[model samples]
Target: MQITTEVVSGLERRLNVTVPAQRVKSQYDARLKRVAKTAKINGFRPGKVPLSRIQAEYGQGIQQDVINDLVRDTVFEAIEQEKIQAVGMPNIESVDVNDAGLTYKALVEVYPVVTVNSFDGLTVERQISTVNDADVDTMVDNLRKQRQSFAVKDGASADGDQVTFDFEGSIDGELFDGGAAKDFKLVLGSNKMIPGFEAGIVGMKAGEEKVIDVTFPADYQAENLAGKLAQFKINVSQVETAQLPEVDAQFLQLFGIDLAPNEGGIEKLKADVRKNMEREVKSSLRNQLKQQAFDAVLAANEIEVPKAMIAEETTRQRKLMLQQFAQQFGGAQQFDESMLPDELFRDKAERSVKLGVLISKVIADANLQVDQDRVKAMIAETAESYEDPSEVIEYYTNDKQQRAQVEAVVLEDQVVDHILAGAKVTEVTVDYQELLKRNQQQQG
Candidate 1:
């Protein structure tokens, strides 16, 4: 057997292997000997069949089987011996088996050679948002609304009030699909209805009739309804105003905030709200900084990624996404598999694969390793957070795959920290209200 390899690309290789004719013949002869021992043919007892007859009967099949096994075994051994960090699987494209030497060729996708320098100098800017008095007051008001009660007001509807209405919708003078509803409740300032629809209802009094015309957004979720102009004939049933809950001990108790009956529960709740808001603000800032670090690294480094790995990762991502979609859409029974296009997700899948490769490479280049102590601590912390702490710990310890997954995350964090250490970091103060507004915009 002879083996040779050629570099097909930066992270790909082609292995060419040849088995000499003599070697093939020797193996065939050895297999024939084994066959003779158990030979069962007409007019011939076991172990007594002629070699020529056996060859004539089953020679091609045995030879083909032997060649297949030999090729598979040799290719794997050769790859291992070459010390290549192959990902996914090798694709065999050419194989020739005959009385002469057997020749086979396969393409292998391997890990890219990665190098890193000046990773410690990565500079990232973080928005340091602080919760101020205004943020605290706003949070308290939101909490009050959360516990608010509604009372019917026999008057015209106004902003910051709820209105109950029965409406018939029409498209081009004809009743349209999903166009009619009875006793729909909408808040005037919530913007729950389409643009201008809620505004059109604000000045109308109870028991009054009105027509609200609004156009659907171009990118509306329902394709058939996108950009469609429709008139809703509505009857205002009743108007109600929200009555906010008092900021007393009872109100504070709703949030597990303990305070004396006559104490300043309002101020205490405000402080608590500010603390929570600051935590969330910092979390968002950290994520932004991490993203910046990733971009900086990608911009400074160039490495060849294996196509085989990308294809494998793409499949994995698609499977995960499809499973999540199915779960959210109720179940497999309700899922229309054809509704999702492979083209729609392919680009995102590829990017995820590329990022994974980059992360792995960065970890290797930076000598980042997951400390066993840290992994154990993380497991212990997670277990402590659960009611059945011991059971959770036992589950993780007993499951090798789960433990390995956790360990991988720890390793990735180490890599992130490594990059962060060398990167330039600047912290700037930001208002909590501004952060909240950005969050709202992102959700919208």
Candidate 2:
């Protein structure tokens, strides 16, 4: 066997492999002998079929099988000999497999050679948030309001009030689809309806009929309805005003808690609120730090990323997202491929692929290995949260791929931790109110 490789690009190569015809003939003959031994014909006794007949019957099938096997075997050998790390599966059709001194060529995309410059002294300010008594008090008040009651009213609908109404909407005097509802309950200040819809409903009194005109959002999901104007003939059914419950013993009891259960009910609530708030703050900090780390690595490394890796990642991301979207739309429904374009997530996919390559390089450079015990501990931790912990653990154990995914996550987390150790993360102290404002701004 003789192998030759030509670099197509930075990460792509064309491999031309030539196998001796004598080798192919020898294997073909050996396969025919094996088949003859197991062959059973009408006249020939079992395990005594003639070689000529066996060859004539199965020669093409045997040749194809042998070609496939040799291609796979030699492809790996070529990769190993050339010291190439492939991105995904090679383009098999690009390979030309034939007989007379068997000649085959395969087009393969290999992983890029990544070089990390530095992660040290990379200054990134992590906004620190605190949960104080005031924040906790606000949280408790909000919780109390969630347990509020509504009083029936004969007055007109107002902000913060609930309204029940029947509405028929039409586009240019012709009723458009999904624009009509019977006795639909809507909250005035919830912002659930299109921009002007809720505002128009706000001043409507019970039993009053009015026509409300509104335009659909320019980027509405339904292409046919985007930026279309519609008039709704609405009849208000009822109006109601909310009455928040007082944060006292009765309200506390509603929360499955008795004041005597803790030294101070308000203080206990404050502690719980603080713990939850701290978790959110930590999560935000982690996300910010990771993004900074990723940006730092990308900026530092000037290596040309493999296009094949990005394309593969893009394909995987699309498939995973489409599967999720299909499940959400309806079970067993065929996904509309036209909805998701390659341009939609091409940049993100490329960034993700590059980040993955950078991380893997760092891990290899540091000689980092996945800790088996840590993976098991993570599995246990995951199962501990479930009611049937043993069953969850057993399920994970049985699913090799799922278990490996979990292990990869654990390993990645370790890598992030290692990067954080070297990263210059500057702590920014912020009050609870200020942090809350910042968070709200970020979300906005």
Off by over 4 Å in 1: 21-64, 117-123, 168-170, 257-268, 326-329, 336-338, 370-417, 440-444
Model 1 lDDT on a 0 to 1 scale: 0.79
Q: Model 2: per-residue lDDT, tens digit, 394-419? A: 98878999899988977876777777
**lDDT values, one for every candidate:** 0.79, 0.79
Worst 10 residues of 2 by lDDT: 92-101
lDDT of 2 at 97: 47
lDDT of 1 by residue, 203-277 (tens): 888899988898989988888788999899999988999899888778888876678665457776776677667
RMSD of each: 4.4, 4.8
Q: What is the lDDT of residue 395 in candidate 2?
A: 86
Candidate 2, residue 246: how far the Cα is off, in Å: 2.5
Clashes of 2: 0
**Shift of residue 262 alpha carbon in model 2, Å:** 4.5
List clashing residue pairs in candidate 2: none
